[model samples]
Structures are given as C-alpha cells and as structure tokens.
Target: MKAVRYTLISGMLLLGMVFMKPTVVVSQCAMCSLNAENSTQHGNTQGKGLNNGILFLLGAPFLIGAGIGILWYKKYRTKSPKQTLLSHHS
Candidate 1:
C-alpha cells in the first residue's frame, strides 16, 4: 500500500512538470467588441429540436397539475360547507 501511494504521488508530480511549458499565440486580426456576434448559432439543428421536444415532455406533468389545481380551486372556492355536506349526502 505504501509503495502504491508513493508511486501515485511521484506520477502526479512528473505529469505536472511535463505540462509546465508556456507558449505565446499571436493573432493578426484586432480583437473585436465583446458583443460583436451575440446571435444564437447552434452547429447542430437536430439537437436543438430534440431539446425542445424533451422540454415539452418534461413540462406536461406540471401543466396538467396546474390545470387540475385551478379547476379544483374554482370548484371549491365559491361553495359553502353546508353545500359540501349536502352534495356528499346525495
């Protein structure tokens, strides 16, 4: 176990040393404004359509629950306790 731990630590140190080189990248075109191209650009069209379909599927339950809750509130909001009891008795 101790040998394995020492080997792992030394491997990490060696990997770090191997990646420590810094190189400068020179670009000719001047840096443009931050908001130069704010338009939506998806390289894959099918992925966007699939995402919308999945979102609608996931949102269906919440929409149904909201509809049911609204209907329940409208059904119960305007009724009195006596009316509820009378309906249950029938």
Candidate 2:
C-alpha cells in the first residue's frame, strides 16, 4: 500500500515536471549584460568569453556536489550490512 502511494506520488511529480514549461533564466545582472552588449557592439570577443566564464562558474558548484555525492555513495555502498553492523558495535 505504501509502495503504491509512493509510486503514484512519484509518477505525478514526474508528469508535472515533464509538462512544465521551462523558463529562461538570465544569469547576468543588468550591469554585466550591459557591459557584454557594449563589448559585442564593438566586435570584441571578450563578451563571448565572459559569458562562457559565467556559465562555467555557475555550473562548477553543481558538478562538485554531484562528484561528492557519487564518491560518498560509492564509499558506503561497498560495505555489507553485517560489516556495517559490526562496525557500529565496535
């Protein structure tokens, strides 16, 4: 019963997310956008470089967090249940 309820909830959430329209997020502040626009108007490549740098900076934390989570899961998942119990007893 509990499993069915959880599955239903998960399905609902999944469908909701699938049906949702994605929003465009502006990562740059007004000043940054203006600077990039001005640079682009002058035909400088700095604006494109700056945008790439911003995207890299924005994505870094999520990548680091996913790496840490994967490492943690790998470290813990290799232990048997009996070994885990014995370790707690010690």
Candidate 3:
C-alpha cells in the first residue's frame, strides 16, 4: 500500500511537471517535415495546420490507450464480495 501510494504520488508529480509548461514535440516523418517547413517558409498556414493535425493524430492513440488501460486497471483492482452456496440437509 505504501509503495502504491508513493508511486501514485510520484506519477502525479511527474505529470504535473509535464503539464506545467507544455512544449511542442515534432511528430512528423522526414518527407512530411520537409514539405511542411517549405510551405511555412512561403507564408502558408497549411503547414502549421498540418503540423497541428499530425500532433493530434500522434497523441490520440496513446490518449485512448491510456484511458482504456486506466479503466481496465480500476475495473480489476476493485474487490467484489463473494457469495457462498447454502446446502440444505434433508
């Protein structure tokens, strides 16, 4: 229990630090990155939008997987009461 509590606290603190100041992470393939950079240099918003869309797509699967994992963990971690069979003697 103590280990679990400490782990949870540590995870929360790490997540807090991460969320405190968000930074943009490049999530583009080499060809896509080159194209986006080239288009942006020419003053086109399409490149910026493309980057944003890529970031969204990159984060979505992990976000969904994390959500599902959390749900599964919670569902299994909980303990349910067990029923006992009653036998009748004639």
Candidate 4:
C-alpha cells in the first residue's frame, strides 16, 4: 500500500512537471525588466515597488504552508501514537 501510494504520487509529480510551462521566476531585481516594460503609464518607481511587494506578500502563505507541511510530514513519518504511548508507559 505504501509502495503503491508512493508510486502514484511520484507519477503525478512527474506528469505535472512534464506538463508545466516554464515560467520566469520574478525574484527581487530580476523583475526590474518586466516592470520597466509595463510601468510606463503608471510611472516606474512606485509601481515597480508596489508590484514587487505584492508579489512578495502573495508568496508568503505558500512558503509558510510548504514549511509547515514539511514539518508535519516529518513528524508523522516515523512512529505511531500507540508506540509513543507504550514508550511512555514503559
């Protein structure tokens, strides 16, 4: 069952990666060029900063959830509740 679940998860991840589009990662200064192109009418300075800040803020939850998920998964990957109780009782 574990092996089957792992296989299915791996297959899905592989499929997702294969089908995903190559999107440019707009991090920090890398977004300058993109902002310059679109910042004409809005003016460059405030718009650029706002856009970058918004993107940064938008990414916060995803980052937090991923970190939490890693820790949560690690916590459950080893022993069972019964084993923990038995160890305590012993």
The number of clashing residue pairs in each candidate reads 0, 0, 0, 0
lDDT order, best first, reads 3, 2, 4, 1
Evaluation by lDDT, superior candidate among 2 and 4: 2
User: Candidate 3: where are CA atoms >4 Å away?
Assistant: 1-21, 78-90
Tens digits of lDDT, candidate 3, 1-90: 966997999899989988886586677889999999999899888888888898888888989998999899888885756555643332
Whole-model lDDT, model 3: 0.84
Output the number of the TM-score-best candidate: 3
Query: Stretches of candidate 4 above 4 Å error?
Result: 1-39, 42-45, 78-90
What TM-score against the true fold does each predicted structure earn? Answer: 0.36, 0.51, 0.62, 0.43
| Weakest lDDT window of 10 consecutive positions for candidate 2 | 77-86
TM-score of 2: 0.51
Q: In model 2, which runs have C-alpha deviations exceeding 4 angstroms?
A: 1-26, 78-90
Question: Any idea how many clashes model 3 has?
Answer: 0
Name the candidate that leads on lDDT: 3
Count steric clashes of candidate 2: 0
Task: Compose the digit string of candidate 2's lDDT tens values, residues 1-90.
Answer: 866997999899989988894664347878999999999899888887887788788988989998999899878875434456668878
True-vs-predicted CA distance for residue 71, candidate 3, Å: 2.0
lDDT tens string, model 4, 1-90? 876998999899989988895665445455765665577566656666666676788789989998999899988787634456668878
Which prediction has more favorable TM-score, 1 or 4? 4
Looking at model 4, residue 79 earns an lDDT score of 60
- Candidates, ranked, TM-score: 3, 2, 4, 1
